[model samples]
Target: MEERVILGTERDFEAFAAAFSRRLHAGDVVALSGPLGSGKTAFVRAVVRCLHGADQSYSPTFTFWHRYEGTPAIDHIDLFRIDDPRESAELGLEEALDGSSIVLVEWWRNAPELVAERRYEIEIEGSGNGPRVVSVRRVT
Candidate 1:
């Protein structure tokens, strides 16, 4: 089953993310997808803050990956620059899925293979001008 919510503002999105954090744990994978300016990074930032009590999350667009320290740690990855699954493997993504930390991936469509059975799939739909419809689903 999927849970859907409409976030009318940034605060609402953050609150949603904060609450969603409780459902996550080590070895889990989260896949986020949305268009530019659709609040994907913001949602992730909130989740990181809620989990670690500090805002250490950032968009891995240019860097490709960012690792955060927490109870179980977090590996944030952005596959926007990757051309294919082969390139994703070249980035050590396979090793990152060793079930030691939580992995949150952006632009997951570019590397669907990285998403495992026990994963959370989040999709945000909007242009940042109004309320965005966010859908959260367990992908197992």
Candidate 2:
């Protein structure tokens, strides 16, 4: 199933994220796909804000992964810098993804093998400005 939304403002985007967070829980993996300058990190931050309320540890471009402490917890991962899928093992990615926290992966196309087989795919179109077309789909 899929839900597509056109968010005209940042507030709309955040509100959408907040509502979207309601449908998630522990062991849920979210794959965020978008080009550079897209609101991939913004979506992550908004979701984190909704889920944990005050702890939004969106991944820095250089970092491979960062975890935010919360009830269900959140694993913010950026595979953008990963040169090889083998690096996932070195990063203990599989360990963190022990079906415990809510995993959010950015630039997931860089290493699809590292993500869970069943997951949500969020695709954001339009970048560096107002109004974004967002599509959320479940792959299972």
Candidate 3:
């Protein structure tokens, strides 16, 4: 079954992320697609916090990706700069995705081909008024 949520504020986004975290596990793949300032990073931070049991998650926008190891390491990747999935492979994404860790990707459109197979796509849309409409599409 598919689920949906409306994040009316930053705290709401964090709550949503935490709820999503409960459903995730090692080897899970989440593809985040949306425009800039759409709360992708915020969502990732929340998930990382749930994983790390802290509130110290940072964006990997410029650094490409970051890995956190604990109970289950999280591989957070940002493909905003990458042009294609092949290029992402060059960054070792193909090898990293062995279904052994949770892979949360931002700017997923940059490497759409990388996620052509089974994956979860989170589409974030601006409401213009307030609250972000996050639509989660599951492809298996």
Instruction: Summarize candidate 3's per-residue lDDT along 65-140 as a digit string, tens digits.
Output: 7876666778888889997557866786664477777888999888877664778888888744479988887889
Worst 10 residues of 1 by lDDT: 54-63
TM-score for each predicted model, relative to the true structure: 0.91, 0.91, 0.86
Query: Which pairs clash (backbone N, Cα, C closer than 3 Å) in model 1?
Result: none
Residue-level lDDT tens digits of model 1 in 1-140: 89999989888889999999888888999999999889787787888898888746543534888777677887888788888777877787665688898888999889898788779999999875788899999978
List per-prediction Cα lDDT, in the order shown: 0.84, 0.85, 0.79
TM-score of model 2 (CA atoms) = 0.91
- Top model by lDDT, which number? 2
Q: Model 2: how large is the Cα RMSD against the reference?
A: 2.3
Candidate 2 residue-wise lDDT, 1-140, digit = tens: 99899999888988998899889989999999988877888888888899888745544433677788788878888888877877766776775589999989999987888888999999998876679999999999
Off by over 4 Å in 3: 55-62, 127-129
Q: Model 1, stretches more than 4 Å misplaced? A: 55-62
lDDT of 1 at 54: 73
